[model samples]
Target: MILVTGATGHLGRAVLDTLLQHTAAHQLAALVRDPAKATDLQARGVSLRVGSYTDPASLAAAMPGIDTVLLISGGGDDDGLQQHQNVIDAARQAGVRRVAYTSRALQDPGTLANELMVRHFQTEDYLKASGLGYILFRNILYMDTLPLFTGPTVLETGINLPGGEGQVSYALRSEMGEAIANVLLQDFTDSRIYHFTGAAAYSFHDVAAALALASGRPVVYHDVAPEVLAARMRERGVPEVAIGRTIGFMTDIKHGQESLVSSDLAAALGRQPTGLLEGIKQLYQL
Candidate 1:
């Protein structure tokens, strides 16, 4: 039996939908915090179990009769390291044979990074010590977030951020979900790590060029100082924490922390991953 946590989320739902193509719904289980939101899954014969990473008993309650678990990492209000540890410990007590984790790509453990990444590295270390067979899917930044970095009138405003000449191998969230499902469907005895990323890396300037081509309008990439960007965001009423996170992400990109390309995603899906220009064009609805 296979159990997937965060089964109602965007990537989680996409993964469940893809997993259904390869296996029966009766063989699947979902760990959801809110049972009300998972009615559709229940109607489809998916076993719905109530659980929260903050609640260890709930996690243990959800793990029975499950052989493999797909643990989708999460962070918001709760300490991510503790939350993942809760799941790992519960899985251990439940005697789950294997665990598949969704992790971020291009993070250096030695260097001081973002708070989000620090928590991820901590979770990875804990999972490594758990003594369970695991598959680490180190996913890249999502391509859907490109439009968020670009303003509403991106065609006119172009791309403005603190990053300079940094490249990111952004992959589509849905595509990555399919890749995860493919991995879950396969059989493996040894623990492994896969870098699920785009086929090519693109800098913000390259993104602006892609936007220009897609929209048939002149677009430019402007590199701004972190303090200046934060000040502008503050003036625009962005929360201090949100501003800090944005700056941290841009700083990481500027330092070449997310510039990585891998064929693992394509190999998993048995097809070429989506191209940068195509993904950008779709984001713009062009």
Candidate 2:
């Protein structure tokens, strides 16, 4: 069976559903922390394996008969290092042949995203060191979160940040889901890594324009100093760690650090991902 950790999460759920449609639900296992949350998935014929990264015993039990394993990084914390290590260790002990891990695109993200990226790097390192056949899929920033980034302003004019007109290729969650399904089914004779991204990059100015058009509202793009922006967030009671990292990340984008689109994902999946405008149009119901 193919087991998916964090199966209850957004990306995981998306991946799971797509996997179900593409293959047999009976052959899939969803490893989750809460059984109640998985009632629907279970009733739909998925095997629900109760597990958590913090609980090594639970993790081992989940992997006992599983074939391919998708180790999605743990949720919402610096705790990923420990949790992922536990999961990987358990997988090793259980003799799972191969592991597919999801990681972040920007390793040195100066944004609030770094906490998890750091852990993703660590988990990936552990998997490599453990001498197992592994697949590293580095996911880019989710295009779905763009709406969240502009939430308050979205209700009126849409929020704007100092994105320096930098172009970043971001993919929709569905495309990511489809690509992951492709990866899970593909032959992996050699150790491989794929950087999953969208078909093209759009500047934040471009994003502002598209969002405005999509929502039928005027959006503004205000470029400010990274430190100044962070200071304002700090004054708004944003945590210090997140503030520093977010600002640093903005600086990186401002300088075009992650401005390019990638073909690696398409090569891996044998399919092209959706473009930004198309995803935005669909998501916003525009």
Candidate 3:
């Protein structure tokens, strides 16, 4: 059986959709914190199991007859690393043959952003310590986030952040989903790490150009220092903690390290991933 955790999330839902295309209904399971939130997926043939990465017993209970488990990362908590370890432990005890994980792109893996990748590293440590076969989906930021950047909010408020000309290895969540599904179904006897991004690399300037072309307006780009951006976010009523995290993300992206293209995702899916301009056209109907 193929079991997917965080099935209610955007990436998890896409994985479940991809899994359904390749496997039978009885062979699929989805872990959710609330079964009712998964009513639509449940009706579509996924076995719903209520569980959390923070709860080992819950993960074990959710792993019945499961040969593979996709551990989606958790967010917005202090103990996220411990939570991921809990899931890995339960998967080991449950005898799951292979486990697929969602990890952030650390680029060089030795920079300040490597701290951002701590959860993934700790999880990997636990999996290896347990002697379980595993696959890692190291995903970069998604370019589809362009809409939000060019959204009504940003449009009305104006674009303001760091990295004016900085390039980003932005990708579509759809492509990330495709890559993860491929890894889960493939015979990854040897553990593997797959970094993911769209076929093309895009920069904030490129995104601004796309938005202007799509919206038929002269959208302007505004770049600011990290502290300035944080202060502005606070003035705009963004919470202090969220402001710090947002600044950190911008700081990481400004290094332009995660902005490069990697064909690993193409190799994984056996096709080129979606491109920036094309995705914007499809999404915005330009």
Candidate 4:
């Protein structure tokens, strides 16, 4: 049977939706922290396995009879690296044939020194040393997160950020989920890493142009200094931690860390990935 962790999350739900199209629900299991939240999945015949990455015993109990496990990265309050190690160790002990992990896409791992990226690198290292067959999906920034970075009134106020002119090859989260599901359904005798990204890289200026075309308005991109952006966010009462993360992400982009364009996503989907303008129109409904 195939097992998916974080099954109630957006990416997990998307993966499960696609998996159900071509596979039997009885052949799948969902690892969830709360069984109460997975009633829909249970009703659909998928076995619910109550577990957390932080809890090794729960993970071990969830792995019996499962051949493959997709380890969706944990978020918020969890020590992500330790959590990943726990899952990896449990899967290894359970004799799962292979394990898949969702990681970020970075062209220069040495340069992208953010806390999150560091943890991903560390996790990858740990997983590699576990002696289990693995699939690493190094995903790009999600097109779905454009609004969060650009703000709600971007069309009215313009796109203002500290990203400079660096470009990002962003893909839709749902599409990435679909690609991941497609990979999981295939044979896993060979270990692999797939850089899931768009066909082209786009900058904040490109985003502005796309917005302008979609909205039929004169949207613009303002490349402000990082300190300036931080001050503006502080004025809006954004938490200091959030502000730091935003700056770090923008800085990484500015240094071309997220600019790598790859066809892995399209190859997995068997079609060209979505473009920036189309994604913008779809996201903003304009």
Index of the highest-TM-score prediction: 4
**Residue range with the least summed lDDT across 10 consecutive positions in model 4:** 112-121
- Cα-based TM-score, every candidate: 0.97, 0.88, 0.92, 0.97
- The parts of candidate 4 lying over 4 Å away from their true place are 76-78
- Cα deviation at 252, candidate 3, in Å, is 0.7
How far residue 29's Cα lies from its native spot in candidate 4, in Å, is: 0.8
Per-residue lDDT tens digits for candidate 4, residues 34-101, read 99999999999999999999899999999999999999988744487899999999999999999899
Runs of candidate 2 exceeding 4 Å displacement: 107-116, 155-159, 231-245, 267-271
Q: Comparing candidate 1 with candidate 4, which one achieves the higher TM-score?
A: 4
lDDT against the true structure, per candidate, is 0.89, 0.77, 0.77, 0.92
lDDT of 1 by residue, 47-121 (tens): 999999999999999999999999999865547788999999999999999888998897574563466677776
| Model 3 global lDDT (CA atoms, 0 to 1) | 0.77
Between prediction 3 and prediction 4, the one with superior TM-score is: 4
Please write out the lDDT profile of model 2 over residues 50-117, one tens digit for every residue: 98889989988898888788998776566768888888888888998888899876634444323435
Candidate 3 least-lDDT 10 residues: 148-157
RMSD of 1: 1.2
Collision count for each candidate, in order = 0, 6, 2, 0
